[model samples]
Target: MSDSTPGRPPALPVTFRPAHTRAVLLTAGAALFVVITLIALLLDHLSPGERVSFVFTAALLAGVLFLLARPKVVADEAGVTVVNIVSRRRLEWAEILQVNLRPGDPWVFLDLSDGTSLPALGIQPGIARQRAVSDARALRALAEDRSTPGDAAPPG
Candidate 1:
């Protein structure tokens, strides 16, 4: 949490993440990995090679869960960094046209000056809708304050 007011940009170097999602994914991944490995170790009926394979399978599942918890958004003095499941992008404030999180949207989106919109998965509404809305508003204010020209009205 930040000291900034509601709908206002927080201090620089703020990070936004799906806190509940990350916690659940990481916890479940660790638990599954531990339980599966223990079962593999305790099963005497299985051959050594079969136990090793079971452990490997558990590791693979845990890896996938780790990937599911990877999305995050980091905002700093230089710009905003968007980290999704498989891709990361850095954007200067001036390059972003608007930040949006419409109703029914899964996550926030950045409308860029290049005319393409980028999904910001870090601020997802799943399990934390209010937090996501606040985060989107703060990001939007930052984009409007830093990127929009002083003479122009900010976009909605």
Candidate 2:
């Protein structure tokens, strides 16, 4: 079935991220960072070494929080881009052979024609599941369309 309505654009390259999870992670991180930094700056009795340590800890916490919230998958007309903390990958639409978003799966897996299972971070199973499923349908449709012999999904 077509997901596109007459006035709406076909959904492809759907971005799936657990919004509440990410928001909580970021908010907590920011609050912790700010609190730690302010305490470090305001504590008049802190030794030079302790102040330096607090600064380091605040920076470290912020960095870790960013890393934790850094994974996402984008499936666009061109292909899919899986961006995880510290690494990223791109696969063309024609390269995807299957889209797997089974029960209990953390995210959808793209079974590539090359025999590798690539994770689609955006089409996750938890948090906003309805949206995730809809995105998955869009992904599968796009992948299938591209796999066909003629009139493949737009890829550029």
Candidate 3:
């Protein structure tokens, strides 16, 4: 019932993520947390409340970095799930009319059947252009392969 069969262009349940970006963001967050915590502990001249504030600020920044590293795209038999910076959306294969990433675009965008475009930030070209291109192509292929002929909308 899936595309795991031999000779298929792609298998089901594929995930695309900005691996390098995520790694850098997460590592930076961890380092920031550690350094800030250490500074808070070492700076005895600062008041207790000020030290607490510094650690709290560090935690807030690290949390933001963690959120920044959370974007990803997942394609499966059911459809595709796009996780952006602060939003998540699920779409059936037929709902995605086209996958687009233009020359100056920062990330992939999905043209929906409803005449709306959704940004797929998980496949960004920030630090990895080739990977983003490949991911966009694969997503396009999957959308083409899985969409029902009559149900698919024409690309505008």
Best by TM-score: 1
> Cα deviation of 78 in candidate 2 (Å)?
2.1
| Candidate closer to the true structure by TM-score (higher is better), 1 or 2 | 1
Ranking by lDDT: 1, 3, 2
- Which parts of model 2 have CA positions greater than 4 angstroms off? 1-9, 12-14, 150-156
TM-score of each: 0.92, 0.80, 0.89
Measured on C-alpha atoms, candidate 1 has an lDDT of: 0.90
lDDT of 2 by residue, 65-127 (tens): 978788777768788787876788998887888888887888888898789897766566576
lDDT of 3 by residue, 56-98 (tens): 9999999999999999999999999999999999999989999
Estimate the lDDT of model 2.
0.76
Output the TM-score of candidate 1.
0.92
Question: In model 3, which range of ten residues has the least summed lDDT?
Answer: 1-10
In candidate 3 the C-alpha lDDT for residue 131 amounts to: 82
The true-versus-predicted C-alpha distance at residue 149 of model 3, in Å, is 2.4
Give each model's whole-structure lDDT: 0.90, 0.76, 0.89
> Considering only N, C-alpha and C atoms within 3 Å, which residue pairs clash in candidate 1?
none
> Which digits, one per residue and each the tens of the lDDT, describe model 1 over residues 1-156?
334696667888889999999999999999999999999999999999999999999999999999999999888877899999999999999989989999999999999999999999999999999889888888887777678565886579
TM-score winner, 1 or 3? 1
